[model samples]
Target: MRTGRTAHLLFLADATSVHTQRWVGAMAARGWRCTVVSRLPHEVPGAEVIALGTGEGNAQWLAAAPRVRSLAHRLRPDVVHGHYITSYGFWAAACGVQPLVLTGWGSDILVSPRESRLVRLLTGWTLRRARLITADSRDMLTEIATYAPRARLEQVYWGADTDKFHPVAKAPWPFRIVSLRAWEPNYHIDVIVEAVALLRQAEPGAAIELHLLGGGSMEAPLRSLVRARGLEPFVHFHGKVDEDRMAALVNQASVSVSVPASDATSVSLLESMASGLPVVVSDLPANRQWVDAAGGFVVPAGQPAPLADALKALLREPRLAEQMGRRNRATVERQASRRSQMDRMDVLYRQVLGWTP
Candidate 1:
């Protein structure tokens, strides 16, 4: 099949997510004619918006398929790219689209596949049908292979905007530990709180503060954990902030923590690395890829004692943390920059469609 001159790309995503917006924007910036069909109310600036009728899961596709088919007929896109493979890709492939590219976003391959036979079968179907598949981490790529052995899967790390997140002059604060993830169960914010409490016990006058950003269902539970652990004074919940403010906040932190129960590739970890902050992350496969001995410390998941030890060690040796932060930032520049990720994605897209450019 001859590839079309103008690549009409369709992104299927949950309406409110920034990931979809970022992907659409990035593709648009590269001059690909883009359309995003989402359950979101607000439309992205540069793409044609098709509002999805249902919330999420397989049932959503029943309502969304006709709308997607209508758009497919109208647009006649060369490639139909689904953002979350299990949800959107299943529908797109079931609709019989050509040159389908399915991108697996973490939990779909890692956690969702373990739920039930029905979900696993559906997810497997999507993976099998896609002409090409992409995952956010090498770990995720391996996980997806377990279900779809013959599927062509590539690891495409979620890139960070290095221009937006970079090193700033060190702040005069004593010890500021920041977390830029949602207050969700998988994130293990409770572990962070416990670690903070332990840090306080060890160093009574340790001028350490924990900054929890983003919001989720776990906010109340996390707050209660903070109070119960006597971390009310040391922990500050900033809710959610805009991208610019978030970058600033991350740059101000002495170190960043991401003690998730499990993760494929965390955008928060990449963002913190880009901002030149030393990270104390879970010793999961995903985190290990980013946090080497030089960049940051990787602690065993769900263990607050070791996490506290790592945090306290960083706090005690500010210069070592600073050096590690610089290394982390360098790693981001070399591996996780937006340009590098987009370049890999563009190549993959072209390969799926058999296009030279």
Candidate 2:
């Protein structure tokens, strides 16, 4: 089923990001041969997966560059696309591949720049070697330019499956407010818990419920916080649901909340918009770029009181929440459609590979 002329795309990333799975699946649907090489296994069907090892960080990558070069030569890839500019991109670039597309995923540009001198230098080297660098948001692109001004940078938002996530009839019983993100410190799930507790106190008789989906290291701590706060009846944690179930849960929610400490572009927020749910998000630049006053409420970060007020306001006014949800859904239809994102990526990939679309 493989054609000799089919572009062999090597996706370099960590195993955790489902965005890689989505992109690889989309590319495969378009008949491109995709192979994912990373530290962990991906659950995507029809895409070839090769786990290069867990501890294969920059140091290991530096030493294994020659081996990776040999593998690349044998595979003879048409384009090597790295999914995280700092780590994976560094290795991909050092392995001597042409038409290298480096994709900077949030923290690589935002947090990594503030890292040690060695990391910054390595990131710079990776960016310099890239044929083109793609970021998920304009904020991320701007951050990346501080280090690699000469590199070709493109802002490509992670595409959400509108068809899968579109508006559904709200589920009856227990009005759900969901947070679908990794239970990491950066994501600030505990903040959501605190806010939800405050919201419950404000509306004592309200049937409001908080649904948390996804797993991470912070799960234990978050759970302890929930128990300590006596939010057992109101808060439910459904750890890492499949896409279908996740979409269903999104559809069931009256409002979706994400109070990230920092972000480039959030796939969860985009998906929430696509699912036609009103959002209450942190007022970070990245979130503000996606959600405005017209679409969702953007509150200050870390403070649970303001966030609780926003949630309570939305809950008190059902019509307002519905209107915001409709606007959010419309925004996704206009801007963040998967087809549009894929179209842009296709052009960028072709340009990098010197192929005519």
Candidate 3:
């Protein structure tokens, strides 16, 4: 399925994820024939998604292997890449394709493995079959070393589109604080809400508005909590927005927050910084790697008091916010450019396909 310029990529990933779509679109735009095989139906602007129509859990994934292998036989893709090593990676490994690339996205490596010894063993088994392994965070890559060879692994960020996410003219009035993460417990959406409440309590009539973006299982609970705190007027739920809209929201904000309990490098954090907004993130190693002292604050993982304090510091000093914003913009451009990272991936793909530059 080679297009004579780039290799056809058969991706085993969650079709619903923006990360998976972006990967598919980027490669397709580069003249590669891309097809995604997934459990759910979804679309990419320039690629194909083949829904597996199976149930969730280990059994379904195991059950879907024959069909996935059949697709590979017909497609004859130059590379078979899988995202989220625990699920899709398992099927990719089962299919026994050559030049396989498995990407361990955050929790599949960091959190999921700790669930049990069998999960870790399964993770390692899936990883060993890959020709190349990639992850966004250094900590995730470091952890991947325990399962697979360090030589085959690379740190590849799910980068932010710097061009599309540049800063826009924003007002201090309404003082919007956007959280780019979903409402899942992994992201601790309630913590951000609690911090917003604290901010209003400490300084009433501050005109602060909390924008909660992305939808998840915790929506009902979070909404109830917001109502319980009497933050209905102040808190807005923007459930599951597209990339363009998400960027606009980020650009219009005074600040951004992402307090995920665990994450690889966050695309939202990068996008926020790219849009020249100083971010407040959990004190995870991956978060620290990006949000340096100048970029934003690193508060305790689950504590709202420290997060509120960080927000207060930024809101109180416009000059300081602008300074941090400048620093953040510079940092993202240097290290987290979407184009540059994708180009790096192109090189890796070329190498795997044994194509000379």
Model 2, TM vs. native: 0.95
Q: TM-score per candidate, in order? A: 0.94, 0.95, 0.96
What tens digits encode model 3's per-residue C-alpha lDDT throughout 1-357?
Answer: 344455678999989888888888888888788899989999876888899889998778777889889888888888899899889988888777888999988899998889978778889888888888999989998898887553388899888899988887777787889998888998999998999899999979689999989899999999999999999998989999988999888899999999988998999999999999988999998999998778889998899999999999998987788888888998889998899899889889888877745
What TM value does model 3 have? 0.96
What lDDT does the true structure give each of the candidates?
A: 0.82, 0.83, 0.88
Report the candidate with higher lDDT, 1 versus 3: 3
lDDT of 2 by residue, 203-281 (tens): 8888988999988899999999999999988888899888999988898799999988888888889999999888999
* Location of the lowest summed lDDT over 10 successive residues in candidate 1: 1-10
Candidate 3 deviates by what RMSD? 1.6
Q: Which candidate achieves the best lDDT against the true structure?
A: 3
Please, what are the lDDT tens digits per residue for candidate 1 over residues 173-218?
Answer: 6699999888988888889999999999998977989999988889
lDDT (C-alpha) at residue 15 in model 2: 50
Off by over 4 Å in 2: 1-4, 54-57, 171-173
lDDT of candidate 3? Answer: 0.88
How displaced is residue 318 in candidate 2, in Å?
0.9
For model 3, name the residue pairs that clash: none
